[model samples]
Every structure is written in C-alpha cells, then in structure tokens.
Target: MNWLVWALLLCSSAMAQEHRDPTLDHHWDLWKKTYGKQYKEKNEEVARRLIWEKNLKTVTLHNLEHSMGMHSYELGMNHLGDMTSEEVISLMSSLRVPSQWPRNVTYKSDPNQKLPDSMDWREKGCVTEVKYQGACGSCWAFSAVGALEAQVKLKTGKLVSLSAQNLVDCSTAKYGNKGCNGGFMTEAFQYIIDNNGIDSEASYPYKAMDGKCQYDVKNRAATCSRYIELPFGSEEALKEAVANKGPVSVGIDASHSSFFLYKTGVYYDPSCTQKVNHGVLVVGYGNLDGKDYWLVKNSWGLHFGDQGYIRKIGRELSLNLGKQSFIPLILLVRSQCQKEESLVNRRSVYKTFFSCMFAEFFTTFKLKVAILLF
Candidate 1:
C-alpha cells in the first residue's frame, strides 16, 4: 500500500532480470567444444545459446532451492542442456505399456519374512556397463536386456552384455513391440523365449535403431523362462524383488522436463505424473538421510544423472496410464523339465523354451515379479 514498498519490489525485479553471469560465454564455448556441437548458421547458434543459458539458470536456481529443502532433487547441465523440452521428450521416452494387461499375479514370497535393508546389483558385479540408447524409443529393449544380462551373470558366472537391438528389431513380429518407436519388456522376454534365445552384445551389438533382423540362434547366450508381477503401488513388492532377484525392470513417468535435467539426490516430485512413459531398471533400494529411494539404472549415457542413474522416491510408482490399472512386477524364477515356470494364470503370450537345455545350471534362480517394466 506504500509507494516505497512498490518501488523496492519493482527495483528488485529489474535487478534480477539485469543480473547475468559475466562468464556465461566462456562456459557456453567450453560446453560446445566438449560436446563437439557445431551450428550450421549464426542464427542457429544464437538460438541454441539462449536455450542453453535458460537451462543453466534453471538448474542453478533449482540446486539452490533444493539445497534449502525446498525440493527433493537437484538438476544438472548435461549434453541435453541445449535441447528443448519437446526434443528431450521425443528422444528420451519410448516405453509403451498396453492399456490392458493381465494383472492377477503377486509374487509375495512371505512378505513377513526378513528382507535386506538395502541392495544394489551393480555392486554385486552382475550389471553390465551403463549404456546410451541415443534417440531410440527402444528403452524397453534396454530395460529387458539389462535384466537379462544380470540374470545371465547370476546363473553363468560371467558378465555378458546382451543385444537390445535384437529385441528392437526382432521382437516386433511375434510380440506387439515397435522397434524404435516403443515396446514392452514382458513381450520382449516372451519374444526371446518363443524365439528360443537372444544374441550376445558382441554377436548382435546395438545400433540404437530399427534395422533388419539378423538374429543368429547359435549366438544365443541367455534365456528367460518366465516373469512374475506384483500388486500395483506396493513398495514392499519391488523392494523384495530387487533384494532377492537380480535387477527388476519397471516403468516411470518421465514426462516432466525436470526429469531430463535430473542429476543427483532422491527424485520426489509431486508434479511428476504417474503415467509411465519411459522404461528403466531398478538395480537397488535403500534409505538416504531418512528418505527412502530406489537406485535406478538409466539407459542414458554416463554424462546424465549421477553417472547414468537416478534415485526415485521409492514410496509410490504405480502406472496410472489410460485404462491401465495392473502390470506385472518382473522377477526371475527357475522351473522343472524344460523349466517353463508357470505363467501367472492369465491371458499371456508366454511360450516355453524347450525343456532340454541345461536348466540344471540355474539352481538359485528365483521368480521374477513383473511390474510393466517395458
């Protein structure tokens, strides 16, 4: 109500706008050179510079706010800094969850049983190197292959990177998977089972694009018999799976831009949607400064999010997509004969991988609780 108060507020706003880091250009130049970014035209360079600067300011302010306990996580300036939100969404998201999937299965192996307080598959030497999916919506493939790789190591005593491209290209026909566009992890597993086996990363390799299916059955290095699912919105179900099973694949809502710039700290945003859009792997879970968090392994390159990983709030991550109420919580289980661990009594496309192979090798193999990981 006073002129002095109004004048001070206006002056403060003006000062804020006028405030600019004098070393912005130097930092911008360094980033461009490091990322090998070369603009074709001057206008393009200027436009990108503006967007990149906006991100710098945004992340800087966010880190400050979160440090003060205003937020749960902090943002970072990575290779995606110059990219617009639309581009990030297009490049980052590729997970496609069927609106309707049988959800009548819960692998609750004695919930009252004692469980580990924390667990991480990477530390156990089961997880392969963190990979980059590039611009492919083939996150579903990466998620499936990541879990398979861990399982293979657990059973075989060797860490072998599996081919995601094999699923991206081949898993499309038998299953409803779209190579570069979108796909499901469960269907990918079924595809591998139906197809007999999947190729190793050395044999098939990843191109991060939809290419001609050149699958070689002789190169099949790993096989998965069955996967299970847990009840939606149940934290204990996932925690148990990660602790007992190797790594569990799951989906999360990555529609927010803040998720794109996510760097470190426990990611807990009320604004983050429950509509799962991207597929990821939950490698471990534990408490951080009294806050429960799930240690997630991302397909993005090592430059993004705490060295290609993020810690999501482990409380609630239920898929609320259109018409999607229940999804399987994936877990690995060993079966008898051809080892066709019974498919959860539901309308599933699960196929048995001829019981003649060395199913005897997997003694400690347990059930995989599915949670729409693809």
Candidate 2:
C-alpha cells in the first residue's frame, strides 16, 4: 500500500501489458494471413473486430472451468467462432436416422471382442485428407465417402478420393439421400452400390449444395459390393471392426458448444445426447494421459477442432456406431475407370493427423492481456 510500491506495481503491470500485446498481435496477424481469402468478401475492419472479440471470449473460457466441470480439453477461436448454438446445429447436425440395426436384417455382433489399446489409421496410411463441407449439412455424405476411400486404399493399394456430390445429387429418389438437407450414410452406400459406383472427387467436385443428378458412367472411380451395419451400442465390436477392417462411419451428437469450440484433448460433454445427430468417420481409438478417446475425422476443414479432427471421449459415444464397414472400393470398377485417372495424382488432398501444440498459444496470449490491464 506504500506510494513507491504502488507506483512500481503499476509500472510493472504496464510493462507486462506491453509484453502481452505483441503475442496477441502475432496471433491476429497469423489468423488474418491464413483466413483472409475466406473473409475477403466481408468488410475487413468488421471481420477483424468480430474475430478479436471471439478470441477474447475464447481466452476467458479457456482459463476458467465451465459449470459442466473441468473440461478435459481446451477451446479457442476458429472458423465457427461467430456462430450461435442453434446456427451450429442447423449447419452441422444433419443426420436424422436412428442408428439402430434393422430387426429384419440379420447382422453380425461381437460385442465382447477384444480391441487394441490404441489404433490410428493415419499411422497405416489408410486415411485420406481432411475435407470441408462448408455450410452444407452434408456430413453424412462425407462420412460415407471417407470410409469408402480408406477401404479403397486398404483393398487395392490405391487411395482414390470418392465424390460426396454424387450422393447429394443422385441418391435422393430411390435411396432417400436428402442432399444437403440430410441423409444416412447407409443409404448413401446403398445408392453407390446400386448405381454401380461413384465418380472421383476431381471428376465430380464438391459444390456443397444439392443439385440435379449428374451421374457420369464414364467417370466411375470406385464401387462397393455391400455395406454392413455394426451392432448398435457395441463399442468393443466397433473397435474390433475398425482395427481389422479400416475406418468406420459413426455418428455423434455434434450440437454441443464444447464440440463447436474444441481445440485439443479428450472431449467429453456430459450434456451431449446419445442421439445420433451428425455423422463423422472414426479413424481410430486411443488413450491420452489416462483418458480414452475416439479419433474422429470431421469435415469442418483444417481450421476447425484439432485440424478438422476431434478426440471425443469413448464412453460418451461408445454405442453410437452405425454402418461401420465398407466392402472393397475396387471390386466393381471398370477398366476405363482405372485408366482414365491416376489414383496417385488424385491423392493430393491427403492430410496428416493434426498436432495440438498451438492450443495454448492463443489462450495464454489473451490471458496475459487480462492480467495486465486489471
């Protein structure tokens, strides 16, 4: 409380504040450089303000444990920073069908099967690139395509990125794929097999919108012999299938705020419902620092989550598996399909698994500013 001590404290605080500003400035500059093209259509000043406010809120949230409990993860500003929960749901939570196995269809179940303590398809070089679905509720199409792409690589030693646009356009009538509005991955696979295959992503590039059926027989890249549904609520069986077969297309309740802001660590939102609202590909499972997690590949782009991926807590989503397997992708392709495009050239969109070294960088920067100014 002495005068000299108080003055010294104030000066020290000012120095600290000056120290923190540069770090935040660096982060803001980095974000602008990375995402400037995406926001170029908007007013640059307005966009910067919005981004700055969101980043501040993210820092506050990151430093405090929410009412839900101490989060096993951290969240920071991302492409979805400005959206509300309802907006996030409308754009992201698109899957509608209950993932229950059909009572009429005889399905295989090995609910008690043993699984590896950890698995990563990326390690095996079977996973494809992380893709962005934009504002389209086409997560089902992407999930199905991801599984099939991995299967293609596993079976034929060729990794071909299949087209989600094919399902969006063509699978509406008979297969009941609702294009961007919503659809089931099972129905998408059924449509692909029924149509004799789907075209490559390059041949039928994603527009992220519903359009008229543009099925090109000449450009068919891969086909499925059959799609199999894994048992509902069987985490062990799902793990076995994923470890032995390849990636499995699974569903998760993707409408949580925690999910929207997730940056790293094993995400477990106790409020997340068991209802399958959005579809994503489960590429593997593992434990980190005593926490079990399902490594999911999402279609929200590299700027979202852990670079377009999420490590959701295994127990919260243990029973949400559906349409877990895809047959060989090359089993039904024609000779013309093989020769028209080189699969190697088409694999340019490949993504390495994202590292979480940068999660603390933004939050720590913002927290320093808060401590200094106060």
Best by lDDT: 1
Shift in Å, residue 262, candidate 2? 0.8
Provide TM-scores for the models. Answer: 0.81, 0.72
Worst 10 residues of 2 by lDDT: 352-361
TM-score, candidate number 1: 0.81
lDDT of 2 by residue, 1-374 (tens): 32322443445434343333444666666665767634332333343344355555664676477435576777867777655455667776687574444542223445565667889998888888999998778998998899888877764678888899988899896776688888888788888878878998999999988898888988987876556555545666567667766787877777766777787777776676666678888888888767777889999889888888986555444424443332111112232333333343555312210111122212322433223222
| Among all candidates shown, the one with the greatest TM-score | 1
Whole-model alpha-carbon lDDT for candidate 1:
0.72
lDDT of 2 at 345: 59
**Model 1 lDDT tens row, 60-152:** 999999979898788998888886666666666778877777676646655686988888888899889899998888888888888878877
Report, for every candidate in turn, its global Cα lDDT versus the true structure: 0.72, 0.67
lDDT computed for candidate 2: 0.67
